[model samples]
Target: MDSPATLEHYKAGMLLSGAGDSTGFKRELNYSGPDIHEAKKQLGGLKNITVKLPDWSVSDDTDLHLATAEALATGKKGEELLQEVALHYVEGMKDMTGREPGGSTIMGASMLKPGTEGGYRIPYNPESGGCGAAMRTMFIGLSPATLEHYKAGMLLSGAGDAIGFKWEFNYSGPDIHEAVKQLGGLKNITVKLPDWSVSDDTVLHLATAEALATGKKGEELLQEVAFRYVEGMKDMTGREPGGSTIMGASMLKPGTEGGYRIPYNPRSGGCGAAMRTMCIGLRYPRPEQLSSLVAVAVETGRMTHPHPTGFLGGLASALFTAYAVQRRPITEWGLGLVKEACPAAKEFVKTAGYAVEETERDWGYFTEKWEWYLELRGLSSGTGPVVWPDPYGPAERDKAYESFSWSGWGGSSGHDAPMIALDALLGAGSNWEELMNRVAFHGGDSDSTAVIACCCWGLLYGTEGVPPGNYSNLEYRDRLENSAEELYKLSH
Candidate 1:
């Protein structure tokens, strides 16, 4: 049997690999097979060729190989190891000027992040057939295997909540921007204690998050969530919660008969349900669990919202987060959720024994609203490709917000909250400032949209680009991060 590679053998292998890479780079770029043979004959032999720096430096393959080796040498394993490798890969970019790095490798490195259940893996790219990964993975084969995972969004979500809450009472539209300008922009607006506190949006979102982190399932989980909601209401004294939320929490009572629930509320089509349901996605984030996510989100949503508008908003928030965990494209998340979740939401409502006629009417309204909004982006029927770029400028976003407005508030209704959040997320891409500008510094229900948008953004990108001070002193940061970690653990 072949013996394992020793230290000396590994060193020799690495040198040999670098030398081979350098040789291949020169040969491929300079000559074809017969031409190279003629050159070899002219030079007396192939061994006569001298491969050295300046004339023949190693390519990106060898650079990445050394990066992988350096990361492994740090002795980090699993998720941390992956992150370290990604870090090294990014750091290695400075040396890649003449190396001609592969496009896929560059893209993967640029996009890679730490502390997710998805690990260091990038989304599937069908056209990424190259030897970049193979060349760099040699050191990975030499290292001992291990696993670890973790999230940073819960803290950032709270940061968004607190920051948005500051503008909730007296600011909207142009006034919100004026306030931000007065405060020297979002970057200078630090998120700290009493000055910047979370509203009821975060209180109830925490309630839902805490319940999900308990690792319970089925009816018992629902019961736990209901209990937390009731308890959460008691803490909303200065938090300025919504009327529907207060009413719903007051009505929630524990019993052995099919968990806590309330009848449909025609007037409760507000963002109350949507703001706090993203945690459901963290708990049941698998693609196969989409139905369960719908059922749970619908049930929890009805505990307060009851109407199709309210419950469906909750479903959208949760489903988007689930899609984020799966690394699905943001363009697909909105329409994708509507198509996959609407039927399940309807089935859940019917199974719970709602009036058939009323149910049909509500479902129709909910489905029609989503269709209208999705169509605005040319995602007609929830199955078409996205044909419009989401708006980023204040005027454009304001126009979009006006289109989503209902009951005089831009994102006041449950449906529009998710709509606005999704639009903001779609436009923001990896830009954190853009996300805050579009979602938080908005006209209506700023905190509601902020909570959902920030959570989904956190899941997809973590807090990589965010300023640390913005989230460092956030209230309830420990709780938020703990819940995020628990959910991340459970997700993996």
Candidate 2:
């Protein structure tokens, strides 16, 4: 190789320390309503702790977090959110080079390898799909790299897959363009992703609509645009739905691909699509401009879920991030107000009293073949499939391993890494317990996650957030930082 390929990642801790000003830190708000009340009741009345929105403001121009936080704080729409994200990127992350790997077999089985080392350097895996990028690269639409360029990056993400985890939070332009075509390009197009892959039809469609609505052209200030395309499709094709989420976005589609899958249940709540929603508001103008964005997001989602549970969930996240950027506390009013705006999240609001009754619950819970009560008593994870070091074991580094499993797909590295790697790209806090921990838990994919997470957190917090350059190499980190700034400019 021409000088040992470089590694990549996001830096969570650093952003916390640097960026913007220290005065930006705000206080936590009073926990209102039954949700906090329930948590307090469950925790034996220990309610309200010092929970301030994470310190630091994204770049000034169009801080996604700030814009999103403002929109949510003041009430806004999904289209506005879209406008905010795309508009900022005209310059924000123009140089960003990691998240969109252009060519490879995706993260799983789809990737191929050249067999020229002594014989075959490694065995070929053909199972995983690059769904992680959809989540980790939460800022892609506004991160420069056009739809066409992003796909090329995605294919290359898993480029080094043959040796170890090679995927990073890079964009794949051409491939993304193709995926868009398959997933229905902007305007009145109809398409879909490969059998196992997901085309960003929903992402692009809404973004496109926002652009068309606002008459924002050339992608200079996309967030300021509208969602006419998304709105247009609402009547005919239906709103964009989450890919195999809780409601069953996978219920049915133009093809038989969705029908064949099992119940459309995503194993996560770890901010998968929520992050995407946040980016929209993040890019929107001010809080007053959020209504359309919020409406579009919720309306688009309703095609598959009339219930609005997820619609509100997405709103909560997007607006919460928006509110967060303003240094506002995550108030009961804030949480309550979200549902008021959309009134959909209330569906999951558990009004009934709750109890935690479990016998000798331990490890291997998810793998257990026990009955209802037994399994409930012992589950690898409850209500969600979490990804992390054994939370129930001797290595009790709970803080060390942030939960990256947003979609309930975790356990072994070999079978479940690509997705994990995606999470690592956006995850905050410490690194893997050890190198072995990184690879052992998720193997090749694990390090990629850790590395990528470092960069994102780094942007949010700064360089100090990282654990040395253990995961990130020189070339990659530089590329990420420059890109992050460019994206920050685009957002501004």
Candidate 3:
């Protein structure tokens, strides 16, 4: 802990270096000499002041810190304050150097700049772990609040990696298209696309990141951010967005029913909600944060998937992911958490346009079916099975497979995909390689399912748990690495 006197000295040194000056520090070493001399005079001839140094042009780091202080003094907090500070940092840097700051500062600041569409910032630079952010975080020091913010940032980064990497393969609906082909034909073949692209999933995740960066929270923030994502996607792609995003966008449009009051279909329970809720879990990883976590998860899910099953699946995924990130024995507690999240899910569905009783009845039926499938595979909510069961051996396996409307059992239903992922993980036991292969071969929603499974596995086993080959060929691998490293730093 730095003493107040030492902190004051440091502040004086920064001030003497022309930290906030837009024009004073332009002359490099010569400019610093005059500033330091003036500082000494102002300090009543303090001879020991270090500001007497000849070279002292403060970089954007100083400007960012000063801007952050100003934002804080003005009652700005969270991502919103960060955005304002970034804007001020950029302006100050440009005024001093006639250009934007270099390195990761520029990269991060550019994304927050006004007029920059959220779509363009997808696949954030993986190589942005420079000292820019760390250097300006002196004010955070050693505090629980600082750790909380760092953890939130790391979680956002991880979500970006998980969603963005999955998007690399699933963009343009290739996985779903291939699953459809296999189902239509008798071929047991799976297709892996060569090129990588992004979709509404990645766009929505980035939008949430932007919202978080600007200190937005709860339902209102998510709704506003989600609408921006829809509009940005429409502008960039010049086509109507697909998947649950279509419904989400509909809810935001002002019309006969009034904006934000539009009805969301109760049956459209796609995996979009589950895929994007991991960040929320990471941001709120404590047992105490569970209520707020569930609330935000439900709000985010209702944006696209108003169904109880839809949002419940997302909530379960987030809670499980958070537990995994905390290195809790997910295999031991995952099922129980799912059960606990169910009541909240049922309550949220009551607010939907569909008949509350019927929706609850349907939800109960679906969950029963899901639990039955788990029991048929010897994966009931009890002791862990020692051996991985063969999916092709039993009559129950066949029945479960047949129950799905698709070849890979890769139904677009949110609950179904998460169940599949959980089953695969529990079944694989300690065999990570086999788990990866099985997930890859699953013909339905392979990429999305794989993303969920991989993220969980990564959380449990860390980076070393993930095979090199899995991400070595993937785009933006560095960014994923950077995110993982930051998370590790924050957690420790």
Candidate 4:
């Protein structure tokens, strides 16, 4: 066997690896065979090759390799070492102008955290079979290894809740823009408290999340969720909790002989149910968990808003969250969701002994709403150039939403809450600022709509574009992150 590698050997290996990367990048050598032979033959002999600095640049793989080496040189261990490596990898993304970084590498690096256990590596991704990992890790013989999207979803949902909650009581309609101007313009809005305290939306969402994180399933999970909802009501000071939710939770009897769910209430169709169900999707995100998602979402929804319109909105939010976590196309996120999940939702209503007749009758209301939304966005025909339209101004938004049969009160009811939120998400594309402007500064129940929208956005794009001040000091941030981490562990 050969002798162990010395300092000079390591140096030589790193330099050569970087040089190889630069040469391969410059040659555009992703594949091999006669094509490479022809290109090399056309270039003549090695005497003509003049690989120099600045001109022949290495790819992001080499940059990340250097980062990894620096991380290893820090003399840290365990979580500290992992944190150092994550920081270096993320910082390396700043100046990758022509580096040709792998998309998976960027995504994985963007999501790395600092302290939590098992937070070093990203979760399994079947499609991430790129050479980025191998190229960057060539120098290291051994090392360590996330559901970062779900975690971001959880955290940013609270951020959206806080910001939107501030606007709920402060501004309405066209005046919200002026309010935004008063708060040092849109970009200057600090996401810290007491200006941006999270309301009942996040509290109830956390209750659902913490309950799901307990790893209970079926009736046990539902019971725990109901218990938490009831318990959550005790600390509603300054939360501005909704009356519908308060009344609904007050009547719940968890661990009782019958069940934790209340009877179907035709009168209740508020946004309360939809706002808190984002965590349900995070808990059950796999294709196999569709039934579980349907059950949990519908059951938890019925716990408060038992009407089909209300409960179905909860199902929609959860389903959309799952779709976002799966990285499904944004265009498909709206109409495709209604097509896919409606059947499962209907089946759950029938088998779960809900008011089947009422659900069958009122379910069309929710379905038609989505269909109308798709039609409005020019997504219903499937033949047209389907682009998620730009976000409408407040007046235009409310004017269009008036046709949804909700008296122009956008996002007031459960059906329209998730709908408006989804519209914001689609329109905003990858822009966090645009997402907040569309969903959080809207007319009715902005906080409720924002909670769902931000969760889906976070799942699709892990808070990369969101300003740090927006979420760094968000209330209950620790609880939200921990809850997300637990749910991510369960899902992954």
Candidate 3 per-residue lDDT, tens place, 1-492, comes to 112223456568556435433233443336577777776577576554344234444556566666655655565655556556656665655643532355767656655663243422325688886766664555543112233333333332333233233433332333434443555521222222243333344445445434444445654566565665556556435222346667566557522233433355766567767665655655566666666667777766666676666666677667766665554544544455546656655665566434466456556644665566556555466455523445442233323433642233453467765665666567655465445444433445544555556556555544433444334444334443444344344323
Which order, best to worst by lDDT?
4, 1, 3, 2
What TM-score, computed on C-alpha atoms, does each candidate reach? 0.71, 0.29, 0.53, 0.70
Report how far off residue 4 is in candidate 3 (Å).
34
Model 4: lowest-lDDT 10 consecutive positions? 138-147
lDDT agreement of model 1 with the native: 0.80
- Candidate 4 residues lying further than 4 Å off, grouped into runs, are 1-145, 381-384, 387-391
lDDT of 1 by residue, 1-492 (tens): 122344677789899899989977776676478887787788778688688878889999999999989988998877788888877887887789889898888888777764555546789899899888898877665531001112555676788889888877643567888888998988887888779888898899899999988998888988999999999988886789998988988888866565478766778888899999988888877778877898889888888888778878999999888777766668777677677778777777778675445656767766787778888877665445555644346656666786787766778888888898988887788899989998998777788889889988887777877988788888888888888778877766
Backbone Cα, N, C clashes tallied per candidate: 1, 131, 6, 2
- lDDT computed for candidate 2: 0.29
Error of 4 at 36 (Å): 22
> Candidate 4 lDDT, tens digit per residue, 2-65?
2224456668889999888887787564476677767767778555666787878888878999
How far in Å is the alpha carbon of 427 misplaced in model 3?
A: 3.1
- Per TM-score, the best of the predicted structures is 1
Lowest lDDT block of 10, candidate 1: 142-151
